[model samples]
Target: MKKKRHLKKEAKIFLIGLGLLIFIIIVILIIPKKEKVLMPLFVGLKKEDAIEFCKLNNCKVDISYEYNIDFEKDEIIKQNKEKNSELKDNEKIEIVISKGINYQVYSDNNVNELGRIPVMMYHGIIDKKSEETSYTGGNVDKDGYQRTYEAFINDLEFYYKSGYRMIRLADYINGKIDCELGKSPIVLTFDDGLSNSIKVTGLDEKGNIIIDPHSAVGILESFKKKYPDFKVTATFFLNGGLFNQKEYNDKIIDWMIKNGYDIGNHTYSHADLTTTTEEETIKEVGRMYKLLKSKTNKFVNIVALPYGTPYKSTHANFKHVLSGTYEGESYQTDCTLRVGWESDYSPFSESFNPQFVKRIRAYDNDGNDFDITYNFKYLETRRYISDGNPNTVVVKNENVEKVTPTNLKIIGY
Candidate 1:
């Protein structure tokens, strides 16, 4: 009986050991397995290439763009991920791309800009249109070689209303084409140094000096106030006697220059260079240069030929028309003005030439085709429109590129 009990106990021990072995095998089978490293590093690759590369590495990509002059378009400018960085599979990497140069629209008020500018010339301002005396002569189509005061005032109003802003000759030449806000640069030049041009005569009831409201200065000042955008400056090409017999000599020149106006030489006696000898030319230009300097103590470097003649006589010296030594001052002109009846190119334009600058004659009721009004009507479409942005340069858009950004925003002159 004892032998049979021992056998049962041995059997129970064997069964328990087999069950524990099965439990150990089941636990090992249910546990998860360790995975291999799948992360990859990506940098300095093109966006498309990088994306594909990331995909190969089981990663993702995100993008953004910004204007850059130094980088080509779509050329990967920057990437958020470090080169050879350990990125997890399906992880997103951010990248930045170059967009070239950017731009903002120039706003419009009454002002506009042009690739070229038109310079208008006025000779004198006529105070009375009803004056009976009529004088006719060379280059003079009528009795009075000027615009009537009322008409002159009206012209200023018209131009100002039409978005024209007067500018100094120096400003134009220096590429300072942008003037007051919402206005275009237009040059106003008065040929003869008529006493009445900048003079103020008579007095109001308050004893205030009453400026003739129709005169050039009067009209400019008044119009400037009315529009507040028109620049109150002009170039007065002075001739012999410098407003001869005018009570205010130095005072007038000083006042004009002080007030932003500029003066230029028109010869000592209005002698035509085409008819004068080389020696005579020097004397004419030289003497006047000295005289103007003594009067205003400023550089008199510009010349308006007497009778609209050439700087050099047809039969005289062959030097540059703008070159000369007047009074040991090396009075070389910065630019010369022509007695013109046509509109001129913008000073800022690449095609503009300082030597052959033209001007348009002021218009009146006389009905001459060459008058300012006539030419203005003919050249209306050519007027400049100031694009609000002064920094942008106007140029052709055909050759535009990312690195070479141009100022030209709008088309047409």
Candidate 2:
């Protein structure tokens, strides 16, 4: 009986140990495993290459695009995170694609370097000289009008042949630099808001009097017909004094705006802003600005100062008073000034200094007057030579003995 009882106790202990072992095994098997982290998308990998890269790491793509890419076609422009960035397992790796290069075309008549555009200024086109002094400024050369038109047409033809595209100032300034304009861009600007502007006249194939708006409009239309892809735009600066007369300003302003032309401020009275008092100048400028804003309901931001006043050669005359990071320089510098003379000598006739530079006088077509390119700098010298008398300066060149024309105007058609 004692031997049998000892054997039963040993069996009970062995069973208890077995149960404990079983419980530990259950605990180990039932516990959840921790999740693994993921890595960031690889940089400089194409979509196909990135696919292979992600596959290697058990990842998937989220998005792909062409426009968002900053690098070459099929080349990676950007990635979501650093190459070593920790990511969750099965994370979607987003990527961007590239279309490589962009080539835009321009059809404007005048284009400069790096998409800097040239503005062509023109005036007065009439079949017959009008008696209306307002329309026919006597200073406008008689034959010169025809010459101006011919030159303009020739210039336009050159642009069209050269594959340039035209764009308006309004469109050009408000958006990203148009690559098209960069290639062969040009702007045709006609100041003084004449009626027979580039707008009014179309083309003169039939040559039937060629009325004002019709005439200018015809020319542009004709050009467009020849070059369907070419874009032609012009800015017309108007003298607001005409607005005072109901028969003139209101009708003309309405017509210009209706025809998709931009009107800029030319001052109310066309006064020379430089010589005029500050107060008078403001009044003149403000009046026109207000009138146009009221008439067209558009902000007149562009002001071609009557006669392009306050010429500066080194820097544009108007500097921004507010300062920023550009140049890391003082804000009070004379950067606002227009680019001054490059050579320090007058670009105008030699006698004229910086002050008289760009002072292109209106032509003197009257019988008593003669027209010559008079540089204000050279004006004093010429006058001294002419004994303080109003006479043409006799210019003698090596090729030609003498070329003298009194009261000459600069040919800037």
Candidate 3:
């Protein structure tokens, strides 16, 4: 009977252990399993894209942007969330985007990359001589050139209204057209340094230098002062006139450098590079270089061939002009300009050809005032649309009619 009692005790112990095991199993079943997913890498993704990415994964997000020159604007520069975490639905993910390189950066024409820049070419600005002069005088000689002062003012007003802002040629070449100018970049290139181009006279009664408000420099300055964003700057290809004014040349060059403008070689006597001997090319180009450098104490690294000829000169002298010894050190022109009557591709765009930087004639083919109005409309019809990723540039309405990037991933794009 004692043996039977011991056996019974053993059975009772076994049953209690089995019952505890069953209870533990029931508790586990009652608890729901946590759904898990691998977190997507959002670095370099645009903000809109990141949001979409999170949503697809059944996750929520908290997003922010900080100014960063290294990363493209609205690009996901950082993230706080850990990847592949097993979590319940609606877990919050923190994303940080870049505020862009130029954010909060003050600029004369602080602007964005529209993937195209129009460099407008202007010659002379003179008062109308007579009723027969009409806007276009057929005399290509001394007196008949460019447009009337009234016409030039109208051009500026139109540009300002059309959301156009000016930038320097060097600025464009170096891709510094990243300002918030509320418009596309328009470069004003005045060929031939006319007396009226700058025309700074005596000082005012107040001691401020008296500027001819109608001169190219004066008008640009006044307009820029009125609308600071317009940027008081231009690229003047120099040969004669003020540039050759022996007594005033030094002063003018100094003034130009000090006032945030640029000067380029138009060949010493405006010689056509195509027809001129290589020696002439070098002499004409080099003379200006030496003169300009001596005055400004800076590298004169730009040239606009007189007639936009001689894109390629077989002579070594031409090469020297393009890139040769200056002040015992090597210097070269960044690019050359042509009398191309068309808009130039944005330097930032892939389509931009360094070999050919085009410029549109500011005056109409008929030399009418405000002829640039048509060019304005041309730029409006199709413009550059930033892809949020600066590395990728898309010309809107050209290929895709009208399309905004969505669900974008650069890996496949």
Model 2 CA RMSD to the hidden true structure, in angstroms: 16.5
Model 1 over residues 1-413: C-alpha lDDT tens digits?
99999999999999999998998888888876655434333333456877777767677778888864446667677877666556776788788777754433333242334334667777777665534324321122363356566666767777777767787776666555666544567888887788668666754586544555666788787776777667768888877678543666666676677777888887777877777787777777777777888887664477776666773334343243366776566556666777777777765455676655777766543446666556666656665556544554443344123212234443322
Order by lDDT, highest first: 3, 1, 2
Please give the lDDT score at residue 53 for candidate 3: 70
Model 2 bad stretches (over 4 Å): 1-45, 48-50, 53-69, 76-116, 128-151, 170-176, 179-182, 198-214, 241-255, 312-413
TM-score of 1: 0.64
lDDT of 2: 0.45
lDDT of 2 by residue, 211-324 (tens): 343344456656767776665556666676442334445555565566556677666777665566655655665666666766776433555555565443322322221122
Q: Each candidate's TM vs. the true structure?
A: 0.64, 0.47, 0.63
User: Clashes in candidate 3: how many?
Assistant: 4
User: Which ranking of candidates, highest TM-score first?
Assistant: 1, 3, 2
List ranges where model 1 is wrong by over 4 Å: 1-114, 129-144, 180-182, 202-211, 311-321, 365-368, 388-392, 399-413
Shift in Å, residue 192, candidate 2? 1.3
